[model samples]
Target chain A: MYPTDCRYTREHEWVRIEDDTCVLGITDFAQNQLGEVVFVETPEVGHVFDAGDEIGTIESVKAVAEVYTPVAGEIVEVNENLKDDPQSVNEDPHGDGWLVKIKYSSSSAFAELMDAAAYEEYTKEGK
Target chain B: MVDFAGWEMPVQYAGVIDEHRAVRSAAGLFDVSHMGQIRVAGAGAQDFVQRLTPNDVAKLAPGRIHLSAFLTPEGTYIDDLLVCKTSPEELLLVVNASNAANDFAWAAAQPHPGLAVEDVSERWALIAIQGPKAAAIVAKLTATDLGTIRNYGFATGQVAGKPAILSRTGYTGEDGFELFVEPADAGAVWDALLDAGAPMGLVPAGLGARDTLRLEAAMPLYGQEIDRETTPWEAGLDWVIKLDKGDFIGRDALVASRARPLTRKLIGYEVVGRGIARHGHKFVSGGREVGVVTSGTFSPTFEKALGMGYVETALAVPGTALEIDVRGRAIPARVVPLPFYKRPR
Candidate 1:
C-alpha cells in the first residue's frame, strides 16, 4: 500500500510534507518498474526548480529515467549517499532513497496533485 | 520478452545478477535458437568459405569449429560468426540472430557455381549449457564422450533420446556445451536438461546475463564493438583475420591498412568513478574527447564497473587514466586488461 500520508504525481513521484519543506522520492512502484538502480544523479543544494522540472536521473543497467520535481521550490538538500550506493533506491525508495528536500514558496503547489488513495488506484489500473 | 531483431526473447528470467552468478557458480541454460545458421556444401565448399572470411577456414578439420567473421571490401565487419565443419564438402556458419538475413544475402550474392548456400535457420534450435558444472549435467543425458570433446570440437549423438549435435563452445569464459537440435526436439531437450540439471544448480538465463558474461570474457558484440565503420584491427581482433591467406574479399584493403599505424584502438576499462559507463558514453582525457565506449556494464563477477571502448592508440595501454561522460557528469576511469573475469582452469 502507498503511504496515505503523502501526495502523488502522475509520473510516479511522492511528496512527504514535513513543515514548510517537503521531502521528495520515487514511489515503490516506480523503483520496481525501473529494476536495479546502478546510478543516481541528484540535484545540488540551493538549485531551484519549477513544478514538473526534471531535477535528476536514475539509471539501471538497461534503462534510464528522469525524476521530475512535484512542486515549485528550491532544493534545500540532496541525497549525497546515492552516488556510490544507488541500490538503496531499489531497496528502500521511499525511505533511505528519498531524493530531495524542497522548500516551496506556497502551499498551492501541492493542490492539483493526486491523493494517496487516488494514486494507488492509478498504478493498479495501469495508468 | 523483448523484441530483438524480429525475435521475441527474454532479457532476464530471474534477474541479471542472479542469473549471472548462477552461470559463474554452477550452470545456466540458454535458448539461443534465434541465432541464424547457413550451410555451404559441394566440392568448392572449403574454397568458398576461405574466400568469404579472412580467417584460414581451410585449416579447420572435420567436426571442429573456429571463431571467424565476414568483412566488407573495406575490411570493416559485417558480422562475427562461428564456422562449424561437418566435413570437407559441407560446413555450417552460425551467425548473430539480428545479422542473419544480411549475412545470408551477402553470402548468397557471391558467385560460387559449385558451392551450395542455404539458410537452414528455421530448421535448427541452438542451446548452450554453460558454467563449471555444465558437463556433469549434460553428461547425464548424452551418449557422446563429453570428456573427450576438446575445445572447438563436436560430435553427433543421442541426447535425451533424441539425435543432437553437441559442441564444446561457449560465450561465457567457462567450460560448456552448445547443443544443436531440431526445432521439433527443442522443447523436449530443454525440459529434459532442466530436469536433469536442477540438481547441479542449473538455471535458465537470458540475454541480460549473456551480455554481462560475454563482456566479462572480453568477447566483442558485432554491432557495438565491431561495426561497419570499425575494422577488426581497430577493435583489437586482428588475431582472427588471416591476412596472408590469399585473395579474400577484404585482402587488398587489409594489406594496405597493415602498413599504416592505427589512429584509434579498443581497450578494456574500469570506472573508478561513481557512474557505470554505458554504450556510446564518451571517453575524455584532459577535457577532450578521446574515444567512445562500445560495451559497458556493471560486472557481476568482479562486483565493479567495466567496459570495452575504442580510444586513441596511445591511450589504449593499461593504466592510462581517462574520464567517461555518463549522463552529464565526467566519471573517472582507467584502461585495464581485457577479460575482466577468467574462470579457474
Candidate 2:
C-alpha cells in the first residue's frame, strides 16, 4: 500500500519529508513492473539536480528504467546498500529501497506533487 | 500480456529471473503455442524441401529433425526453421510466428509438382517443458521412451490421453521436450504437465524467460541475430549450409559468399560497466562506430550483463576491448566466447 504521508509523481517516484531533508524512492508499482532489480546506479551525494532530471537508473534482468527526481534539490545521501543488494528495490521499494535523500530549495514543488490517492489513480489509468 | 505476432502472450508468470533460474536448476514449462507449423506432403516433398533450404534434407531420416533456413536467392534469410521428417514423402516445417504468413506464401509460390505446402499452424499448439527435471516429468504422462529419442528426434504418441507429436528438442540450452498437440487438447496437456512437474519444481514460464534462456545459449533470434540482410556465413550459422549437398535456392549465393572474406562476424560480449547494453546500441572503439548490439540481457545464470552483436572481424576475437553507447554514455565491454552459459553434462 502507498503511504499517506508521501507525495508521488506520475513517473512513479515517491518523496516524503523527513526532518530537514526528504527521502526519494520509486513506488512499489514501478518496482513490480520492472521485475527483479539486478543493479541500480544512483547519483553521487552532493550532486545537484532540478525537478524531472534523471537521477538514477534501475536495471532488471531484461530491461532498464530511469528514476527521475521530483523536486529541485542537492543530493545529501544515497542508499549505498543498493550497490550490493539491488533487490531491495523489489523487496521493499518504499523503505530500504529509498534511492536518495535531498535537501530541497523550494517547498512549492512538493505541494504540486500528487498524494497517495492520486498516484494510485494515475497508475490505474495508465494500465 | 503483450501481443506477440498477433498472439496475446504472457511476458512472465512468477517472474523472469525466478523462472529462468528454475529452468537452469529444476524445470520450467512454457506455452509456445504461438509458433507456426507448416506441413509439406506428397510424392515430391523431399525433393521440394531440398530445393528450398540450404541444409541437406536427405540426411533427415524418418523421425529425425534438423535446424535449417529458408533463404532468398541472394542467400539472405527468409526465415530460420526446423525441418522434421515424419517420413520420406512428408515433412513438417516449424517457422517463426512473426514470419509464418510470409514463409507459407514463399513456399507455396515455388513450382513443385506432386507436392502440397499447407499452413497447419492453427490446427496445432506447442508447449515446451525445459530444464534438468523436464524428462522425468514428461515420462510420467507419455508412452514414448525418453531415452530412445535423441536430440532433434521426435515421435508420435499420446500425452495426457491426447494425441501428440513429442519432440526431444528445445530452444533452451537444457534438456527438454516440445509437445505438439491439437488446439483443443493444448490446455489439458499444459495442465497435466504442470501438475506432474509441480513437485519436481516446474514453474509456468513466459516469453521473458524464453528470451533470456535462448540468449544465454547463444541461439539466434530471427529479427535480432539473423535477418534478411544477414547471410549465414556472417551469423556463425555456416554449419547449417550444405554447399555440396546439391543445387538449392541459395546454394550459388552461399558458395559465392564463402569465397570472400567476411567483413563482420557475430560475437558475444560482457558489459564491464554497471548498465546493461541493449539491442541497437552502437559499439565504438576510439569514438568510431564499429558494430551494433543485436541481443543483450543481464543473464540470470551468469549474473552478468551479456550480449551478442555483429562487430568488425578484426575485433571479434575474445578479450578484445570495446565500448557500447548506452544512451549517451559509453560503457566498457569485452568480447567473450559465444554462449555465456552451458549446462553440465
What lDDT tens digits, residue by residue, belong to model 1 across residues B57-155? 888989899999889999899999999998878999999999999999999999979788999999899999999999999999987888789889999
| Recovered share of real interface contacts in candidate 1 | 0.26
Highest-scoring model, TM-score: 2
Q: Compared with the real two-chain complex, what DockQ does model 2 have? A: 0.83
TM-score of each: 0.95, 0.98
RMSD of each: 1.9, 1.1
TM-score of 2: 0.98
lDDT of 2 by residue, B18-91 (tens): 99999999999999998898899999799999999988899888999999999999999999999999987899
The residue-by-residue lDDT of candidate 1 on A15-122, one tens digit each, is 989999999999999988877777788888999998889999887766678999878999999998897788899889889998999998777878878898999999
Q: Which ranges of candidate 1 are over 4 A from the true structure?
A: A79-85, A120-127
Each candidate's DockQ score against the native complex? Answer: 0.53, 0.83
Candidate 2: tens digits of C-alpha lDDT, residues A1-127: 6999999998899999987689999999999999999989899999999988999899898689999988899999999999899999999999999999999888788888999999999898974
**Model 1 Cα shift for residue B3 (angstroms):** 0.7
